[model samples]
Every structure is written in C-alpha cells, then in structure tokens.
Target: MDADHLLTRRTVLATATAGVAAGAFPQTSVARRLRREPFARAGTFASGVASGQPNQRGITLWTRLHDIGASERLGMEIARDPGFARVVHRETIRAAAVRDFTARTRVLTRRLDPGERYFYRFFTRTTQSPVGAFKTLRPPDSREPVRIGWFSCQRYEHGFFTPHAGLAAEEDLDLVVSLGDYLYEEDSPAKLAEREQSTGDPNGHVETLEQWRAKHRLYRSDASLQAMHAAHPVIAIWDDCEVEGNWAGEGPSSGPSPVGPRSVPFSVKQRNGFLTFFENMPQEPIGSERFRIYRRLRLGGLVDLFLLDTRKYRDPQPCEDATFEGDVPPCLDADRPGRKRVGPAQQRWLTAGLERAQATWKVLGNAQMMMALDIAPTRPVGYDSWDGYGAERRAILEQVRASGVENLVSIVGDVHTFFAGELHTTGRIGSPVVGTEFVGTSVSHDGIEVVGDEQQSALVTDRIVLSNPHLRYAKFGVRGYSVLEARPDELRVDFKGVRSVLAPTSETYLLKSFRVAAGTPRVRPA
Candidate 1:
C-alpha cells in the first residue's frame, strides 16, 4: 500500500473512538500480550518528544526511536502533574519501522480538562523518554488571553537555534507556532562549509524519502530545537524550503531545481517531502487525499487561529514562472482574475471562518508576507509571496472588509526579515486597511544576503517602507522570532531578536512592539 494510504488508514483506526471518554485501546487480550513482551533497550529516543494539535480536550504526541531494529512495543502515559502520580491516560503503542520508527498518537480523553497543563512521556519497560508538557485549549466561550510564540526559516547550517532556546524558556507562552521552513532542503556552499566544520555532516540537498528523513533527523539533533518541542505544543506549517525553495503545488518546475540530482521528479520530491514532514511533525494524519495542512483552531473567545498551506494549493506566480524570485517588470497577468494564493476551497473555508468567527481576534498563520513590498513606486517585488497574486489578495481583503471582520491579524514568516504592515484591499498604499500583518524574521537565515551588504540592505528596506505608506516597520538582517498576545480589547506583537545565532548562547532583546486595537485593522507601534 502507498505510504500515504497506509498512514491514513492507521489514523482512521486510531481516531475511530475519538468520541469515547478514554483513548481507543487494543483489546484486553492483545493489550496483555503486548505488555508482557520483553522491553527492547537497544536504541534511544534521541529526537525527544513533541505535542501539537491542541484542543479543548487533548493533543497529539510524537517521538522517534533511533538505532532500533524492527517494531517495538512502547508504553505511553499522560498525567496531570510532572510526577505522573496522577496519571490520566496510559496505553501500549508500537514504534514501527514502516513509519520510520516514529510513534505519534492522539490523547483525546474526556478525563483531560480544558485550559489545563499536562505532562507526557514515552517509555519501554526499561528506557524512558523525556517528559513533555502541553496545555489544552480553553473553551470557546472563555475570555482569557492567549500568548503565542512563532518563528520560521531555521536553516541548521546557518547558525545555532538560540532563538528556539529562548522560546523554550518562555514559561508564559500558551503555544509555539512554527511558521514553516522548519528545515531547509538545500544549503548554500558557504553554509554547507560551515556545517561540515561544525557538525561534520556533509549531507547537502535532500531529494529522496530517506534523504528527507535524514534531513529532519539532522535538524532534530539540535538540542535547542528539541528543547522547544519538549517545552510547548507547536502548531507547524511549511514554506518553500521544506521541499524546494520556491515550489508551488501545481506549477512548471515547481520552483527552482534543488542543488542535487534532478533525476527525481518534482512530484516524487514533493510526495517525499510531505511524507517526511508528517512523519516528523506532531500533527494528525489526513486521510488519503493530498495532505491538507490548512486548518483553524479556536482559543476561547480571544482567537481563531487559521493555519494556511499557502504553497500546496496556490497557483503559479503571475507574469513569470513560479520559480522566479525577486522584482520583475509590471505585467498584466498579475492583475488577472482567478489566480489563487490560497485555492478556491481554502478561500471559501477562510472566508467563511473569518466571517463566522466570533473570537476577538482572527489570526492567520500565514507562511509568507501578505503585505505588498514595493521597491519603487507602484512596482512590487517578491512574487513568491501574496504580491504575485494581486487579484486574489484583494478579493480576500475585500471580503474581510465587506463582512466587517474586525481585529484581523496575520502572523507570517519567510522572507527572513521583520515586517509590520497593514493589509489593504488593494496592493497600493492608501487603500482601505482590512487587517494587520506581522512578519517575523527567520530563526537563523541571513536576511542581509537577500538584498546586499548591511548598508545596502538597510537602504533598500528604508526605500521599501517609504514607498509603501501602509508599512509601519521594516527591519532587515535580523534573526529571531515574534510573540503575539491576544486579549479581548487588543492584539500585541513583539519582535524578539537575538544578539547572534553564530554563538551557541546569545541574549534576546525586544526589537520592536506593535499593537492593534479591537476594531482597528491598522498596526501601531506600542
């Protein structure tokens, strides 16, 4: 059977008893037999444990066993406290080679309470994995504040994940969001040289399934990244680097050719990327169809978080091929109707969700910048983002404006810079503001390289901000993450930057802060 199909079937079987009070467990006899099997102590759970997809009732937990042979039965436990003295749920699960020795299970028991913290761990009879913790979401009617930390574009070879460590230490964060580029598929020669010197892993472009899996493993080897996963539940989404740099789900070239062999078809590479992503991340499997990552999560009366898969369902970039990056001459194709950033189904889903959402803040977990970036008057750059699909972006903004969806904020990644701007109905400045967009800087990717030297990049960013009136802030050559706190009356975002990612340990400081009032869609410096 196809791997996607197999995982889908497994997910169906696992979630069959979702409505029951306790987790769906094996039969009594089979459970007893599995429990009696001798523990395997040959391998280690080096990847650490992760929890995600949190709901009012439960969340998904994930971990991988390294250096293990064949399948092994493991014990799983969830508790109300770190001590495990008050265990709420326990089950015997298998870590199978078919799934890359990774075990991901959903613990959705009625016994679990909402707005509560829980600890979990995976173990064999002998070895125990690190204990992980997560907090279940509050009920939709509750009026509590929600604190979220988000980061993106962490190419392992670029620098140490110091920002991730900082986020891991944030005890007040209710959730951590990974807005894509979780791991880069290819690294530049300079970065590769650095990796060879540092980690001694010469692994370059990842194309095949095993290569993709290896890349994920290599990234997961980062203790800081693993610490962040162990500390908080993550809501992860992918950007271009997870597969090819500028890939579109349906397009010629599917963005640029990777650094290694092009023998593998783009479709195969895409499938392999998605397979490894699902296998490694703490997300539930989507049944058989092309894996859909766009979904909404409600956080009491404060937030309705819409996580979008902008790459998978988007149409090709306008005027030029989808693989093309940077500024291009103005063309008619960009304004043409029916070009989609998020396809029709997703558009409808997002529109309906925004229109019907009663939460105080409607947050879009966008993978790329949605604000227009004009280097010159009326000339937009970066077609890889929403600037490529002008008509669709306008449509969505217009719908939001028409429906009176207030307190709209989009938290974005990719582009490797920090940006705070207003989402206008039209791409041009002075148009009616429909929402606010806060684009976070990369975890380690160099934003200065995207432009030129430090001075040149600063000049270019200044020009961009001056050219676009709606843009409130633009800072290039920074490496860090952003924290968003949503309350009933306002939404506040703080861009946190690290002193250096080259050093294993660095201090973080607030680069900037912005806030949006309840009914206002404009961004203002806080």
Candidate 2:
C-alpha cells in the first residue's frame, strides 16, 4: 500500500472518538424534561428496532432516538402477552448523546419463556413506538430444533434493504446472524447510480469514529433493519468494508498486488474501529481489545454458532508484484509480495473453538470465504481474501480435520455473491471435503456488476463450481438473505433473493435451497 494513503486514512480518523466517553453529554434542561415525546413513532426517525444476543435467561433490546442536539430517555416494556395491560419488565434507560441516543437495555424477566414469542417496544414521553415481537433462546439443557436467518454484506447505497424486510415479515426465525459488512465505509462510486442524502455527518467516505457511528446511525435509520431488529435478535460481526476495504489490522491501505505481509503491516488504529463499533452495537461480556469478537453462542443443544473476527487480527493482504498500482492486472504472476493471510493467534482460536464444540450443528459466522478459489491464480491476483494466504488456509483446514468436529457449516459474506461449497482438509483427504459452506450474496451493495452478459456470467459460475468439486452452487447476480432451519436429524438452508435493491419496496424470490443430514458435513439438494 502507498504511504500517503495509509497516512491519509489515519489522519481522517484521528480525534474522531472525542467526547465519546461515558457520561460525556451535558445534563438536560428543566424545560426539556416537561416537553412532549420526540421521535415517539418507530417508523418516523428511529426507523426501526432490534433485539439480539439472546440467552435462555434474557435478551437485549435496542432502539435509537433520532433527534437533533437533545438526547431522549427511552423506555421499553416487554410482555409475555402482546397487550401492555400486563407488563413483565419495564425499563426506562437514558439514551445519551454520546452513543447517538440509542437505548440498549437488557430486560431480565422470567416471564420471557424460552422459545416462546414475546412483544416489546420503546416508550418516550407519553407515546409508544411500534411493538416488535421476538423469542428467547431455549435453556442450555434443552435440546430442540432452532431456525435462524444467516446473512451478511448489506450495503446501503448499492440497492434497497428489502431483504431485511422480507426476513422480518416473511419468516418465523429465532434470530438473524449477520456475518459482516452491516455498513460500508466507502461505497463503490462507479457502481452507484443514485446517492442517499447525508444524515448527521458528512457523506463521501466514513473514516473517523464519528463518521463510522454516523454510518451506523444511517443504517439503523432504515425501516427494514429496524423491523428485523424488532422481530428477532441479530447476531452480527464486521467485514473489512465495515471499517475499510480490505483493511487488515493497522496496515498500509494498498500495496504489492497480492502477496504482501504475513500479518498486520501497520498501526493499532484499525483495532480502534472495533472499539467504536461495540459502542454503537449491542454486545455482551466485554473484554480486552485484542481478541474480543471471537465468541460462541449456543441455542440450547441444537446449534452452536461461532461468530469470528476475520479482519481484526489478520495479517495485511499481499499482492503479486512489489510495486503494483490499483487493482491487480489479470494474467500476472501469483507469487507477488502482498498476498492475503491470517495470523497464528486467530487460526489457533478458530481451531480450538471448532475442536471443543459439542453442539449438533457448529456453524461458523465468518466474514470471508474459507474455501480456496482460483481467482487469477495463473496471473496477478488480489490477496485480500483466502486466495491470498495459502499456508494459513491450509493450516486452518488441517485443524478442522484434526478436530473431527461434525456438522461444521460456515456462513459467509463479503464477495457480494451466493456460494455453496464443501471445505476439504486437502486434495487427498478421504472425504476431500470436511464441511459445508454457504456464502450469502450482498444485501444491497453492487453484485456481479463487472460480469455483464448473462451467458458469460453463468459460464464463469459454472467454471468455479466445476474446478472446485466441493463447490455445489454459485449465484453471482442474486441479492438477498438466507434462512437456516435446523432439525434434530437434518439442517436445511433456503436462499431468498430480492429483485432489485435500487427501490425501497422490492419483491423477493426463492433463489435456491440446500440441506445436510444430522451428522453429514456436505449439503445435498433439499
């Protein structure tokens, strides 16, 4: 990467976290206390609501109070019954200016029965917001089937977020797992046909902490995202674009075309983005800055979903040449300096997590692809993905083999395409493929735009599937979400796609479906 680009990225983010500490906002005036509710309606400014990180015992409720200058004190009422006539737990929390007046509270009430539906909504002033319904995870001791919606790569400007709306109303899922790219920091300018008006912060590019928070606010303001939050809890993690495109820790922004550094080649500023992210998003069991996002959530005994942090601790992506410029040229050498690769610590953590997992289904919530790809292997290639780091990818597969974890399924995003495949330890393993992976296409971002002709695109997809025997399906042009249903004896996945995201309300369609037996790792046609 160029030195100027690296310096520019850092300079833009400096002091962005100012006035962000706890209790940083000034006290409210007496006159405001007596004022009527602001943003009382859910659809008006708050846009939507969401619940996440659910355990059998409790769940976290989230809503942002969208107002200028003043902060709003939001209240939530969770009830077993839909009517507020019988309230289970009522929480009145302060949504201060520091966190964009977003109220994230944990409502611990025994009344929220496991696997049973419950209604919740925010209250400000005398007005009540729209009521949203969600369910709690079954107890750890209970072993029952669970259904979840897994998706990633939701870019705001590329298209509409109709997928979220579809998932919100079209399915009865316990939760939605978002692997990454919840918000894109920099958009693909050439690909955007229309631009969304800037909300509170400046538009162009989001580099500073304020810009990132504002981007999150912009996304949360969407009705579809809020509705999904209202219906079911969301399990989310960040991809490179969430902070920066292909950013690996604190490193040079761009460099040698595909094989560069084996690990982080720059500073600690990259890690700071994760800190800012946790501030806006609701997460649990806060810990040290080093390896925080690599945690596991168990849905009773039916499933154990491991949300991985692929960008945080990984090494800088490598390029094919020492002094390449812009995107790598096709038909160039693959043995260049800047190939993408992961560090040892993250690899070890993933191996241990997979090895120790005892759930019937071990689903990895990964941000990028785990399977090897032949994307310009014979020429100059981009190493920001798994293709950049052969050794690291090999070690990861080896660990999976040694661990012998059954029903290992990986749900991924980032490429803006739908990909289904099996993960093999190596070219010589008995099964060749040890686990199955389903990559969700982008929610709204530009998808397969570079591939124009339908016949040509279909041929490319076919070649990718044909060359990689483990790859069963590939849809490069679809845009949508995924619904994963896990039964005692089988696991089924349905890929739902939206027609076009350029408009607000788009029609949805079923793109494809796949399933795996209780103990099998390969996904068969459902």
Candidate 3:
C-alpha cells in the first residue's frame, strides 16, 4: 500500500488498540507499533523527521528512535510524485543504540530529475512517517532563478516558533539555510525570561550526550518545526549556542589553567552530541581530507552559496584564559590581550572560497555580525564582534575586493536583531563598496532585549550608519526571518518581522527591503 494508506491503517490500529474510551491507547498504540513491530522504541522517540543535503543525484534523510537499542532496521522510500503510486527506490537502515538510534540513508534514485518535485517518507513494519518533499538543484546552465528563505536562533522558552510555521506556508522557497543556535545549552528557569513558560525541565543544563539529543528531540516536537522539516531541504551551520555558550578550542575554565593536563568534562559526550546534531540535521557533514566545515552549492548559476562553520577552528575567547570570573572583558579593545578571536585556518578557507566563486551572486551563510559597530562603549570595553578581530576581518574583506567578487551578501544571525551593512576597509586596498550584507533577526530569541530605553537599539543603528558611509540599514527591536531573492540583473532581500513571538499566532510584516545589481557592490532601497 502507499505511504498515506500505511499511516491511515496504522492510525486506525492505534485508535482501536487504545480503545475509544481509553485515550491513553492512541498515544501508546503509536509507541507500541513503533517498538513492537518495526524497531525497539526506547527513549522519547516521536521527535519527527527532516531531509537535507540535496544534490542532482539524491538527498539525505534523517530520524532518531528514542530507545537506546532499537535493535531493528528501518525502510525508507522516495518517489517522483507524492502519492508514491510509482516508487523510485527504497532502502533499509540498521540503527543502533550506540548512535542514539539515529539513522541516515543516502539514497541514490533516478527520481531526481531537473524541474521535478518529489516526495519521500520513512517507514517501519507498523509505522510510516508523514511525507516530505524536495527538489533537485537545477543545473548551472538553467536560466530560471531559485528562491530561498534563511533564518537562525530559536530559544524554545522565549516564544513559540510561529515564524517557522509561516515559512512552511510560503509557496516559493526551494530551501532554507539555518545559520545556527539550533538549540541552547542552558535549559534553566533562571536563564529564561520570567514571562516565558516551558513545559519540561527549564534551565536543565545540557552538558552530556543524552541531554543534547533530548534537547534536539524537544525542538522537533514543535508542530511548526515539524511542518518546516516536511516542506523543503535545509542548508545549516552551528554557532556558539549549539555547544556551550561562548566555548572555544582551549580554555582555562573557572580558574587558572593547570600546569599539566586536567580532566575535561564529557569531551567524548559532547562530541557524540555533535554527532547527534548531525544525525538530526538535513545536511551531511562535509568529510574532506582537512575535514573542513565549508561547502558550496549552486542554483542554476543564479546564486552560489558558501556555508561555513565559524565556531570549530576558532581561538578560545580571551576571557577563557583569565583567572577571574566576576565579569568578562571587552573584545574590541586593541590593547586587551584577551579578546574574542577567530583562528587562522578558517580565515584562509573563507578567503580561498571567495576567490574561487563563479556565480551571478555570491552569498555567505555566516553566524554573527561581520561588520564592526561600537555597542555600549561608554561602559569600558567597546565590542565583541568583527571589531575585535580587526586583522582577520580586514583580510577577508580585502580578498573579496581583490578577487573581484561582485554582489556579495552575507546573511548572519546571533545578537537577536536585523542588520544591513557594507564592508568598509580603512584604505583603498579593498573595493570602495566591498559588498552588501543582510543579518536576519532571531526566530524567537530574547524579544526586545535592547539596552537602555527601546531608543538604544535605534540609536546604535543610526550611529553605525552615520559613521560608515557604506553601511545601509539596521533594525534591532523586531524578530523573524528573511527572504532572499535574486535575478540575473538585480537581487532583493526582504526582512520579514513577526508582530509578536510570545504567542502561537504571531503575524509577519515586511519590515524592510534592499537590492543590489549584478555589477554593483553596494545595496540600495528597492
């Protein structure tokens, strides 16, 4: 039978098994069917499904069974059409407790044809998941433009994922690029806003492997997140929050570093957590010789995307080496020996990628602000962003100018606000107007947490704009996602802000729009 028929039959069985009078049976029926027949369900397994890592050949499929030892294999199917009347290919995945019962099957099917839509579903003996649809990346020679929605940072307790639901309803986007903060490390009640409410274990810190996997499961439980997973493939990269907040490669910890090796907490467990993250995400880990965390994808020559990992190869934050803990030091001060930092390896990778890019528009899927801005300078230290990494930031901007890469746009998250600016270097070494950038606001992060009065966010945005001639726009108070569209002649970016994130029914409004031409490095109001 087809996938829908399979689910219908299973649901009927679930209802019957539960018995109409006993509501417990319906939920139990699903769990029972999943464990007894197909796989041995153990932990909290109803985390849902996601598909990503698309190519002309095939795409990646992901799901996790909660039980530590599922001790069973899963069957997955993909079709050229949704009905599955004509199945293209199928496979069985042997999942185990060692990997958190997570399974991934890189299916090779002829069903991936240009300009065609396809449907996919994962199945076991008694249970079949809802269907997901994906399309192949159009060949570089094709003339039609492909559209995409990009976003980042969703703290579950702060608000509902209403914006994600809106994105799922959008009829046009071919994919979504998530630039990290997929899950937060601190799940404590105190860390979250007092007004916010979460059902389970608020502020339950996730320092172990199991906690991380469970957190990913918790996020997947949101209906809006599940719906988005079923709609389109996603290109993603993790930032600080995915791991420990502001964690670096090396650290002194709470006190001074020991002269000898000290026991690091759950290093293996944290690595496993990263693996679980990979298992659940749609994108496959790019396994190259150097094990680089960078990948490039093209959409019919209309757009080229470079997604990078800024967290992995970076120098530990300067404060990591400090002996004191009352307060962290400022990263912007040139004199501060301990400042926020980025390593050399990542800098080299990004510069090389920009030099090699060949597309109508080159987009950088980054995690935090690349443009320098002084936020709250009066206090003592100046900043924490690219301003702190002055040397590295200049080098990257110089490469963009020297490589002659036109129409560059960097989409970033973190800092929970919307920002638009141009890369400005001190000298004539770089392009006068190096490129354009659009920083998407958070999905449901700390809402309106600007410093001082609500006016502070605007004041900071205005001063940065006035100080830098190349910088174009900045809005901090709103929260939501961004729609990035490009044609051969012009590219448009729209910042869609939700009216409120605290509720399930938040409304989206177009807060701003900016465009850049194929030859122009600067963006202008459209």
Candidate 4:
C-alpha cells in the first residue's frame, strides 16, 4: 500500500459497515433521497445483464443498477425471443445496498426445454436494459462438440480489453472460462495515466471492503469486459491478484522490495476480495459460504470441467516465500508430509472425481502452470509455481498415470506466458511424461517476447526444445487468450494473439496451435 493511501484500521471497518445497510442504497440520507434522480435522469441499468453457473436445471442471472432509490424492487423479465413476444420467466428482485446494488437470481428452467436460447433484460420503473441472449448447454451424453474460451491476467492499466471484445464478437463459445487475475489491485501513476484514470489523489494498493467494491465497479465500467459477460456464460476462478499477488493460504501478496514476499496477514483484504467477487460474479451460494469458487461443471458428459481453487487453501511457497523471480535450494518444508497446492481435501475430491468420471474428456481449469521449467542444476527456478511444490506435482501426475485416466488436459493461466507441452513427473526432461498442459498468455500483462536466455529466436527455440523435451511449444512475448475445442477423441488448443494491448483497436489472430490425442501424452501442431 502507498504511504499516502493507507487508512486506519478503525476507519476502514467503520467505513465499510456504514456504507452497507439493508435497502438503503446510498450511505448519505440526502443521496438516498436523491437516488431516484440519478435513476430517473439516466438509465439505471448501466453494468448490463450476465448469466453463469449454468446447469441442466437452471442458470444464475446477474445485473447491477448504476443508481438505485431507497428500497427499490427491480423487475426481471425473460423470454425466448429478443422482441419479448413471449415472456417465459418473470420475477421481482430486491436491489439493496447489502448486495452492493446488484441482483443475482437463479431461475430453474425445468419449465422450459434444455439447450434453448433465451433473451433476458432487467426493468426499473420505466427503464429497460438491453436484452442479453445465451444458449443452454446440450443434454447429457449428447457427444456434442464443446467450444470453450479461457482467458486470464488482465491488468486494467497496462492495456485495453479489446481481446475480450473480440472474443465476445467472434468466438461462438459454449463456456467462457476466466482463470483469474480478473483485476489488478494496485494502481500507479504510470498505469493510471495510460488507462486515462484521473485520480487526483495518489492511488495505492486496494485493502478494504470499500476499495474492493470500488475496484469491481471500475472494471465493470469497461465496455469490452461488460460486453464479454453479456455475451456468454462465464465460468471463473480467481488467482492471486483478486486478493493479492502470489498469495497462498492466509498470506500477503508479492510485490517489490518494500512489499516483501511475506509482507503481512491480509485476512481482511482476502475476505473483502471474496465478498466483492461473489457480489460481481453470477455463482449461486455453494454450500453455506459466500465464497468458494472451486466447483465442477458438466458439459453434456462429453467434458467434465473441474475448476480448482489454488490460492485459498494451501501451504505457503516452499522456497521461503519467493516471488516469480526468486529461487534457491529446495526446502524440506515443500514435502513436509502435508504440503499441497490444492490441499488434502481438494486433492482427495479431485482424485475421486477423476477416477469415477464418465465423461470422454476430463479438463482441469488451473490457475498456475504445471510445466517444470528445467533450469540448470545450479540455478533455482520460480518458487511460486508447481516447480516449488515438486512432490505435489509428482503425486497428481502419478495419480493420472496410475488410474489409466486417458484424455486429460490442464488449461492454466498466471505467469503471463504461453506454454504448450507435455507434463513430466520429475523436473528432468528424461522423466516419464504423464499428461498435456497449455498455459495461456496474459490478456494485458507484459509479454516476455524473448524466449530462452538469448534474444535470437532460433537459438531460444532450440534451447527450450533441448532443455525440456516434453515441451513442444514455448513463447513468452504476446498478449492474448487460448481457445480449447474438445471432441470425443482429441482436444485442440489455439493460442490467439493480439499485436498489442496498448493499441485499443488491435486485431487478434492465431499465433500458434497444438493438438493432444486421447491416451497420448504428447503435443503436436494441429
């Protein structure tokens, strides 16, 4: 946190408590009385509508009112056609400040047939939002091809969200998977200026409930991110940035020299991060908790999507809490019997799910990469990734091989680099290979562009290939997302790249692609 932006702990708590009151959308009585003025003067529905947590029986609908009066009751109208000729589902949703003036309602669609397209919009008094259309997932055991687009790591200040805009316009995807780093919590003059943010006061790293809510609002204000949500059903999982960078269980975020790897206990920030995350996302209450984003999605039994939560419940990094650039001798604590990336309970659950899965393809939606970056024996690699937890990685790969579980692929984000390769049990390239891994580049983060230790493209490619035999593709310099097209027999991934995120009007094209066949642990150009 910037010294200038730091707030007293008492002030932070009081501000959050005072701002949130049931039915009172505004904290100030005067604003509460004048809330209707903003709502009436302009359209109340500014963030638009989105649908997620899609299952065979129902889907969750979400919307945020740019302005709301005291004790306002919003109307939700759903239909099969865009013109609203036939309204199928109608309900009243309460828009209160307790939920940050957002409505997340789940509608059970057993009344309607499955796989039908539906148009939905929200109503406030006399205003009506634009209708959003979404297609339902196909029936069970249908063997229908599933088109999924997964993206992550969009720093609001680094560049435009044009990739999201392009994905919304061009990709006909069944599910939009956001693998985390949805928003950066820190804001600097350089970044703020680039994003055209006019914060007269010095903005610091976010650390409170109010700050979290404000950050969510600012990100949703972007048209590209809003359009992407409105266009498809998004299945999302958070990485470190949502709360803090490289944050493990009950840990602080990683930052520069001042903000050390293990800086402070951010229990408050973590809770607030999750609170705003649920308030913004369309997930229903899983179990009795407001948080907990790790859940599985079934796509007609053709694919079983296991969304894992890597940041929440886990031991700290094994190598003395190091950053992405930090490395040292392996620590004994890494394999201290119970150290885990997904933890013990999640590991058991995932193991059981994979063993009993009946789907043709089992897909793991992960936050960090699985590839063991084979550095020299004298050099230490990044401690914030699976490379830090070598034992856990070996266990999962061994589980996959032991179960004879064919057709497994892990789609990951974070690290802001692209990697298409085979998963080896040990860090050595000669180790036994198990499954396939495709790590997508960041949407707006800085791209490594330079492969290997050298700038020469040919030498870098040759070095990467020779150093890690399991890796078939490697590129660090690019800003884009990945497309995963899954069939019964094979899974194809396209690493789509944009020329520059700094350019608002940049176009997206395929940079590279690879295919992994069923029962084979190899990556080849499609």
Best by TM-score: 1
Best by lDDT: 1
Query: What lDDT score belongs to each candidate, Candidate 1 first?
Result: 0.81, 0.67, 0.66, 0.73
Model 2, position 350, has a per-residue lDDT of 71
Candidate 1 per-residue lDDT, tens place, 1-526, comes to 8764563344333322232324344558866554444344446889999999999898999999887777776667788888776878876566777789898998888988999999988876446788999999999899889999999999787888889888998876788999999988875544544454222134455678878887888888888888999999998998888888778765433335444456477788788888999899999654465678888999888999999889988877665553224444575677688887789988999999999999999999999877887777767765767887888889998998999898889999988889898888886677887889999999988884534676776677677789888888888878999999998888999999999988777998889999899998878899
Candidate 3, residues 16-101: lDDT per residue as tens digits? 33323343334766545544434322233366667777777678887765544445656566777777767676655545566667
For model 2 the local lDDT of residue 255 reads 51
Between candidates 1 and 3, name the one with more favorable TM-score: 1
Question: How does residue 39 of candidate 1 score in lDDT?
Answer: 42
lDDT by residue (tens digit), candidate 2, 50-156: 77888776888776666546654555677776665455766555566676566688777677777777887775543456788778888766667788897778777
- Candidate 4 lDDT tens digits, 254-291: 33322333223478767888888989888765666567
Candidate 4: deviation at residue 444, Å?
A: 0.7
Better of 3 and 4 by TM-score: 4
* Candidates arranged by lDDT, highest first: 1, 4, 2, 3
For candidate 4, give the lDDT: 0.73
**Which of candidates 1 and 4 reaches a greater TM-score?**
1
